[model samples]
Target: MRSEPLRFFAWNLGLPLAIALAIFAVFDLTSLDEIISNWLYYPNHEFPFGHNRLFENLTHRWPRIIPDLTGEAAIIGSILSFIWPLMKPGKHDRLLRLLEALRIAPLLRFTARYRRDFLFIVVSFAVITGMIHFFKSHTSIYCPVETTLYGGTMEKKEWFENFSLFHEAGPGRCWPGGHASGGFTMVALYFVARRHQWRHARAILYASTLLGAIYGTTRVLQGWHFMSHTFWAGVIVWISALLTALAFYGWRRLASPAVQAPGSAPPAPEQALSGLG
Candidate 1:
């Protein structure tokens, strides 16, 4: 049997995923999407109408801000962290020299042990974001603002109903909340947390989830997406990160020797060598 920590980790990662799938299975999110979008949306006005009024304008466009901070900015920071050790600071200025030693040097040492894991995390982020964009382009789903519901031209669509991969519904390209994926991609931190200092990792995971949800909400407010789009984006990102972590950890586990019981006979050399042949 696996250890208790492993069991707990699996449960922690799994329960929400199960809930997400169940929600998608049983509920049609169109009506709720309309309700939320209508609440914030003002269809009649120009420049800043509907959900866009609050999220995109009144809040100084936090939808863009949050994703930039959490998504691209975070990824860039991770890359820099991984490479901080390789950076050769010139003896140019007292301020620059002091900053490099006090900040960059410590960060470099701290991140050195996790360099491989950091690379994996970055790759996972790229894959998840790339998948989101691919689906967004191919799914051919329109945004709420573009739909008739919010006074646009195209027909509104329920999740996965009458959907096609190649069909082009209209100019609307708002399926799966690409912006929300930016926030959801932060789940990479959760994968990193699995290795050590799990409490901190849990905190990071929660923070990332919350930020992603909030970012999705902002888009909904702008009538840019249905709630289902954002919800699916989060689920996709979580699942992607989970699979990535499992792939890495499972490979390591399989490569290591299994623990044997006391007085257990060692495997026959021929039997052990059989697979190689």
Candidate 2:
């Protein structure tokens, strides 16, 4: 099989991006946002926060912890990628000890070992967060908590409807569910496992996707975002990571002649093209 960046991009990023767009379109046309929001919210104009608002309180607390945990994880991955070669740790050193305490030592070790692959993971987190924030800042789409149905100020605007290119009211920072981006950023983990362990990569990819969905669902229940908002966040993150991985492989192929040669086999493959094909 040949190393083809366009083919890789089409399968890994283009298709998933199209799916995400379709999802956003379907939810917009069907008014599923309002429907789902209504189902989760009680007649009292409040979320079903459980007895005496236990769930509401819990959901509220998530905003505080989720960003720090996920952002710090991404930052750590990037930092470790840059510093892995410089720092050497013993079998049971403090860095590993700390990672073990956080239950992410295996991920840290894996990223350190496959440093190049992990670069895409780091890039994915940055790109996903940046794009989500850009939309959240520019788009005037209000969150469910801000909509009239939930007893807030603004009317519930569809994904592509509200906001002007020149001047628009910034209702609040509430589009695309930035909190959920944290979970979806785990899509980078998929790239780390994709090369040598295709099966494991599939499992990791699905698990990361599911984790993002669950995180987004939590935001939906809390009225901070609609289901579609979180869905798009996951989609964007996945696509960003996929494209970054494609770029990585493209660069590897260019840098190493053996990987690109028609009849030559490299020590480590520049790509595993069967899946992309």
| lDDT value, candidate 2, whole model | 0.64
Q: Provide the global lDDT of candidate 1 against the true structure.
A: 0.63
Most TM-score-accurate candidate: 2
Q: What is the C-alpha RMSD of each candidate to the true structure, in Å?
A: 10.1, 8.3
Cα lDDT tens digits, model 2, 174-232, are 77777677777776766655544444767877877776787778878778888888887
Which regions in candidate 1 have their CA more than 4 angstroms from the true location?
2-14, 38-105, 162-171, 251-277
Candidate 1, 14-109: lDDT as tens digits: 676786877676546436666666666655442133434444563335545654564554455556554444444353356446655777545543
- Candidate 2: segments with Cα more than 4 A from true spot: 1-7, 50-113, 163-171, 251-277
TM-score of 2: 0.69
Ten-residue stretch with the least lDDT total in model 1: 268-277
Query: Lowest summed lDDT over 10 consecutive residues: which window, candidate 2?
Result: 268-277
- lDDT per prediction? 0.63, 0.64
* Deviation in Å, model 2, residue 249 alpha carbon: 3.4
